[model samples]
Target: MGPDDAFWEDGEWVSWDEIHQQIQYKEWRAKWPNADLSLVPVFEDLISVAEDYFLATGRHLQVYGDIGELYAAITYGIRLHKNFAQGSDGRLGNDHIEVKTIAPMNTKDQTSVKLSGHFNKLLVVNISEEFEISSRMIDRASLPKTSGNILKIRWDDLA
Candidate 1:
């Protein structure tokens, strides 16, 4: 098992979109302590706009990055830092976490990590076209040392 097996459950993933749909006719889980339920509607709006835009034109909007980041924050109880924050994106409890978001439309099922980023852990969030989200959270110590501005991690490796 990987270093994150205990927390991530062998890369087991959950679909917030599916859950949201189930409660569409009702109320959202406002008390999800770690998550900002308000952002849910905004994210959904973005999704709807993207879908509409795609249908209108043959182009895509690449909005999944934010969606992916938000997933990591909510799932792992990370409190995100302000915009343009250097190094890590947020903190999970007392540990800093670097979040890498994988866009579904990408030709490859992988993500780019910043070598210069600071964090105690690395959280990679992958979002499917259906908005089904999944993630791989690994302790920083588990990552191999490399020299470069960026590093790549494939979904296969995480799984």
Candidate 2:
């Protein structure tokens, strides 16, 4: 209905978690009453707040909210977390998400077999890339292995 509305409707969205600083849990709760905070507006408000916080403090904030709620928000380019969700899926739709299990392992190098999951026919991306994997993380699941750390994961399983 307005120029700004039109701009948003057609605009490309950047992930909120990628750019925001930590949110004060108490402040966030005070501002967003449950059942009333729509995804886009919340994300926009958080980004704006984060920008200011970063300018004044020179640091990014980690937001605290239900992971499921946050996951649902980022699909439209907004995300809230103390740490950005590490993964390539973007948490949008099955087309870009997947669930995998590690293969069994012995005491050799390390190998894994991706079990089942859903993802867009496009390439699967790793979310953990943003986080540091500990050296002590020694197990089949410590790291995921696809043909090249990514592939076109199956899509029906997510449902």
Candidate 3:
């Protein structure tokens, strides 16, 4: 697992919430100046697409980094337990939802770790633009049985 990746099963949730509440783009960019925002529009666009897909298909959608530790933390946030099953439209209707981030490892980088764990009913989604390294990677996994309307996003449509 990468330093950024965390295992929620044994990690604290407050840290995740803390980062979520505190981290912003401006502040984030101050830390990593070379960061690119070209993908910002793409991120927004993909989010809307995922939202629409979820609404139309009632599927559970999540965004994550390619690192396993990061995604594990996300899955932990969703409270994934053993023997979890897929809900309607390939979603987990339980208190926690199943979403993940699967990024391809760089073949040139021999030290890269694999984040793709075997999920019998896992639903993974990727939302990143080519060659754009995002700094504010977040995992927004939902809790099980959280009754609410299907996602309805508002964003710019390149489509």
> Ten consecutive residues with minimal summed lDDT in candidate 3?
150-159
Candidate 1 residues 56-99, lDDT tens each?
88577877777667776656668889989999999878899898
Query: In model 1, where do residues sit more than 4 Å from their true spots?
Result: 1-27, 30-33
- Measured against the true structure, the TM-scores of the candidates, in listed sequence, are 0.72, 0.27, 0.23
Instruction: Quickly count the clashes in candidate 2.
Output: 13
lDDT of 3 by residue, 11-73 (tens): 653455455535665563564354343333444465566556656876535442323223333
List per-prediction Cα lDDT, in the order shown. Answer: 0.74, 0.33, 0.35
Q: Model 2: runs farther than 4 Å from truth?
A: 1-37, 63-117, 121-147, 150-159
Candidate 2 lDDT score at position 70: 40
Model 3 regions lying over 4 Å from their true place = 1-34, 60-159
What tens digits encode model 2's per-residue C-alpha lDDT throughout 51-152?
566577866455312222343343333222234443422333333432222111112222232334332322211122222111111122423355564332
The prediction achieving the highest lDDT against the true structure is 1
Against the true structure, candidate 3 reaches a TM-score of: 0.23
